[model samples]
Target: MNAVFPTLVPDHRCGFWTDGADELETALRRRADVLREAAGEGTRLLDLAALPDGDGAFDAVIGDQCLEHAVTPEQRLRGQHLGVLSRIFARAHALTVPGTRMALTTLTAGRLPRSAATNRALVDVVREIPLWRRCLRPEDVAKACGRWWEVREVDTHQHDYARTALAWLGRLRDREAPLRAEFGDQCYAACLRAVQTFAGAIEDNQLSLVRLTLWRTDQ
Candidate 1:
């Protein structure tokens, strides 16, 4: 798992895998005492960008909403996001043996049931939100996989994403007072706008939540 909090230790004694940025590492260090007590030696938090030398150690790799933020907005705008994704796939391939599987979920730009202009507009709106760096199409993802991976399945969950966004929006509205106080009015307003825009895009079929299942090919 990349950038996900491990809630349960593996019962099979296999190590729990997770990685994140430096800020996340610092935050985790603050809770080191509690985490050390709860996780003991089962958890191994690593650096995603520079994974240590452990060839063919992991059975599977899972990343949820991690790929969307893999690169910066500048990289995406410069048409370097696909190259970065390909490199990431290659690195993952080097760490696993043939037949190893990888599952990733990310926000993708939708191209059906809506006009191209509308879809582009929606993408632009969401791209303006903080931490939302990349929003590639399904075809772009497949292209990035290249020879390192064989794509098994690509599933879209626009409705599910819209529902989740709506629920989040409702919660935000309910706690607007405390949230505004904590994050300030401007930050709170930005979050509310971001969620609303995301929900609208998903509802209009302009944006989708995509899950991809891929297998490492012999390389």
Candidate 2:
């Protein structure tokens, strides 16, 4: 199954996946190869949103912790640049020859209704008072994806993800010397701090995963 990666970034290496691997071991091997190629610089990852005639022809798509930053939130819920999102979804739909699936991992704030209401309140208050903008909530993501795709699953990566992020932050801190040498001190420090913030937020249940899948029906 071919997949499209919209708004893909160059410097932040995301990782890799393989298609049609029912066996775990086989998929692991294929994933290892993809990782090796990603690390070895054999494949040229291009920006999908920028590709000309970049529609249709894939069976599935996988995105992790992306799309939120792809377009500004103002552009999403406020009915701005929705055409772009629809176009991407159309291509993804065409890729699946009907009854196929698209699995995506996106950043969301979970499905608790009260939490959503509170977050909205926070956003409204911030909008009026002018403080830091809160991150996107799962409801926002659901509304966005529901525009073009039928969602099948929504999972909250609450506490475990926080632990994972903390672990990653710790590892990055440990590799400070090498990271500083490669990326310079300022960038490395900023990234390290960002990692900690993300972990803290996730563990605190302020950030979550809005797991989703979409299947195209013959129309």
Off by over 4 Å in 2: 1-57, 73-83, 110-135, 146-148, 177-188
Highest-TM-score candidate: 1
Candidate 1 segments whose C-alpha is farther than 4 A from its true place: 1-50, 53-56, 111-130
The top-ranked prediction according to lDDT is: 1
Provide TM-scores for the models.
Answer: 0.68, 0.56
Candidate 2: worst-modelled 10 consecutive residues by lDDT:
1-10
lDDT scores in order: 0.61, 0.47
Tens-digit lDDT string for candidate 1 (108-211): 86645446765565555545454444677788779999998888877676655665566567767888898778767876776676667767777887678776
| lDDT, candidate 2, at 217 | 48
